[model samples]
Target: MAKTSSSHYALKFHRTSTWTMFLVYVILLVSLPDSSQEDCHCQNGCTDFPGSPCPGTTCQPDWFGSYCQKRNIARGKSTSQSSELQGYGGPFPSDKAVDGSTDQTLQHGSCTHTGDTTSTGAWWRVDINTTLEIRRMRIYLRRQNTDRNMGLQVNVSDQLCYTLSADNRQQTVLNIDCGEALNGSSVKISVNGPYLTLCEVQIFQCSNGWFGDDCDKQCQCQNTTEVCDKETGNCRGGCAAGKHGPGCQQECNDGWFGSYCNKQCQCLTASEACNKETGHCSSGCAAGKQGPGCRQDCGQHHYGVNCSSTCGQCSGTSDCEKDDGTCTQGCQQGYSPPLCKMCAVHFYGPPCQGCGHCKDDSPCSVLNGTCLTGCKPGYEPPLCITACIPGRYGENCLHTCGHCQINGSCNAQTGRCERNCQPGYMGPLCIQECADYTYGINCSSVCSCLNQSEVCDKITGDCRTGHQSTTTAAAGASAAHQGQGYDDIRLIVVSCLLAISCVYAVITTATIYRIRRSMKILKAEQMQQYSTLQVRGESSVYDVIAERSVYANESIQRHGDQDPNKN
Candidate 1:
């Protein structure tokens, strides 16, 4: 009545066979690395990332982490069961990427990689194993630890999706349009650093900027232009030129403000009295106040106005009476006269005996605002109207222009001018014309001119031929042609590498799958045989091998046609 070892083994095999096979199936579904990961280059035109894969071309070595840059998912439950089957390592947040799998028709088992897989900086990325037309994408994060966090960032490309960040542990949700990658065959997602575990990822058919069932557009202020939350209409903190503040609100800088930061304020200095509101200073202050706001009076013998004109020393008293600026008793009745006015020559003055015949040769003829002596050479004219022309400069055409005429600046000591024409301006004073084929900021580059090549000015950085040349007007084609040349070379190299990678990926995956399948079948039969033998029944190793042969053949056939990742 007691079971033998062989029988016990057989019993275990039969009881656990279903679960075992299912476990193996699950492993195959999730654990196996996707073949698409190997040839992740995009099939669609590169629109988002700077150097993502292009249609009909393998990606160049350079990469951008996200498949479609920063995308938001518009819909789908974050906890759908089918999502678990999406091929990737995470049911939990992963270090390298976030990805999923489905039974959509596959070409090369394509997937996406997000964020950087290389840098020490935070990064995240993802890869899609099958082609699915996505509606939208969502990337969400909750209460972040800013100090510990570098920041939250994501990039998605067609080939490899990578994600990384110093403080990405709070990130939780990311949704993307399934259709976006459907035609291309892959979706890549990346993060700057680490992102918190995902809740779910759903694919739907939605408009480019639309999100949710309502198809509401995303932050709409501008394309990639950081705007304030769409609902609030606030712009992002960093703004473009001439714009400032959250969503570019509250412009204020360069001494300007109000609506557009265009208002200017006057310059103020400690020595001048300034208008409080406008910051301008028009005149001196009143008595009792001195600095900046001047309300103080004059000193000692001086009183009103500016403390400049002085009152005479009267014979009656030592000080002037109350601000009358003169002795209340009147210069001791010294005959007659105002406080400080000097006496005329014929009539005795109160302060100086007289004006002393007022000499015309004294040079102070202008009085308060005059020069004490005759003017110098260049300074002879009343207003000094003329500036030295061309070759002449200084007090009276006194100095030579420094250096040669080719350069333009005078000598520091003599006021002489000099010149250096650089390349394009090859003539005298750096004014001669440049070569027929060169132009740029420094004249260091040649015009990549062909048919009607762009003729840039050799001396002044002006386009010598653009106004007359037809080639200058066809910039678009020229640019495209250039890109084509570079792209063609890049494509050739990439294609070769991709082909090799794809082939290697396929072979490796098939080998692993076959080996794993074979092992499972053999193990199961061994268990079965052991159980039978223990029960006093018999079955050989050959029986176990035979049972798996058919399954093996079928697996091999399937791999030949279907994608190896799905296997």
Candidate 2:
């Protein structure tokens, strides 16, 4: 009886301990948080709940997260689906998925549902309007009928983000993390079957140039205006000023600056580069250029470094070129071209005039137009500007001209006569007297004087008094007769002498006649021979002289035949 009682007491105590452990396990299981409920808490402070009143704040537009700090980029965006279900929860549309509601009930009309069809590829989509780096996506589904969500896919711009498996389909809420973030303008949820459903969908991204899960990390972007990728921290719009590399962390190479390091420095020294931010050269501008950028050209009429050089004498009133200070319209008269700083050759004076004829065609003085080497022929003197006067010619007008037909007329340079010389003169200068029994203008007329040895008067061709001695003797004889008395013995003596002189003159005349006649006869015969030779074209100079002599003899015979005593 004592052994049985002890066994019964031990059995009762073990049964009591087992029941207490079962009760503890049941309590712990009941108190744990449900996986289907949202794990979010009011960040700013929510004032109300769907079924209960509370002192908490509602999230602002596009705001989400525990602290309401992150932005839901897909809220209230445009939405569409493959097909709408019209009856069961009537008018279930795609926009219901992004209406900022997380309600999963079909009767409340907040969830999206596609019509039942035989086609596979049932889908729902939302356009966020602009492209963004999506960090993650959160989706809410109906609590019951979760098996219909299996094989569902989340896509950003048609790129697969996540796919639901049979094991995780039972979960009412889904959190999809987009590794490295996805760049897209629209988001889509697709299923293999024709039926699809969603209560709410949220898309998230970091702020400009910020990335990471908490969006606390800053991006190293080259361009300040460009946004970096949310996951990779890379600038998609290229590097900023003076920077390069994929992440925009590298400094620009030498002599390069500005966006993507594409701009080159314009410093005065070619080896030096300009400031990276402002593109300013530390040194002065290059020649013919000015301004802070060293890109603008010098002002008109100014050139060289800093535009310090002035222009030269250019034509008109226009200014010179800005580069080399040259005259583009040509230089002033008598001035050299291009720079125009000096007088041209053969030119002179500030007013500038052409030079006179110089000796050996040499250049004249630039200041006074003076022929430094002396004047050329026909030109007079110190300035060599005047020509030699009439009748005066030769070098420096020193030599006189010849006695030309027109008095004082000759070439100024050579002193050559214009026409023939004066009467009683010969030769080019007309200074030589007539010679060779010739006395006339140009010494062309022959002199006919009785004395063979004496030439005629150079001016008049008059013979000497001795040439007419017979006339003078006759006059003397008449004078003596008048002075003497008429005596018989003198008259008788004069008569006898006169008679004798007459008879002797007649005899002498007859003798001369006979000789002349004989000479005429001989000359006539020679003339006949000359005529015959002329007819035969064989006449000579002697034949012509013989013919003339014959005619002269005939004339002398006719004269001789006349009586000398007769008048």
Q: Please provide, for model 1 over 1-567, each residue's C-alpha lDDT reduced to its tens digit, 9 standing for 90 to 100.
A: 356888998988997997899999998899876643433333464443233424444333222123322222322212211111233432232311223322121222321222333444433333344444443455433223333223433333343222334444444444333322334333333223433223223333323322233222233333344533422334443333334444443335544322233333332333442443233335543322233323334566665444554656555556553245664555543223456343322223333332112223232222232223432332222222334444444443454443233445443324533445344544333334556655532345455434346665554445534443456545744775698799999999999999999999999879889987876787687667555553322456555555666676687678567864665
Model 2's alpha-carbon lDDT is 0.74
What are the RMSD figures for all models against the true structure?
68.5, 28.1
Q: After superposition, how far is residue 84 of candidate 2 from its true place, in Å?
A: 24
**Model 1 lowest lDDT segment of ten:** 76-85
The local lDDT score (0 to 100) that residue 415 gets in candidate 2 is: 70
lDDT (C-alpha, whole model) for all candidates:
0.41, 0.74
- TM-score of candidate 1 against the unseen true structure: 0.17
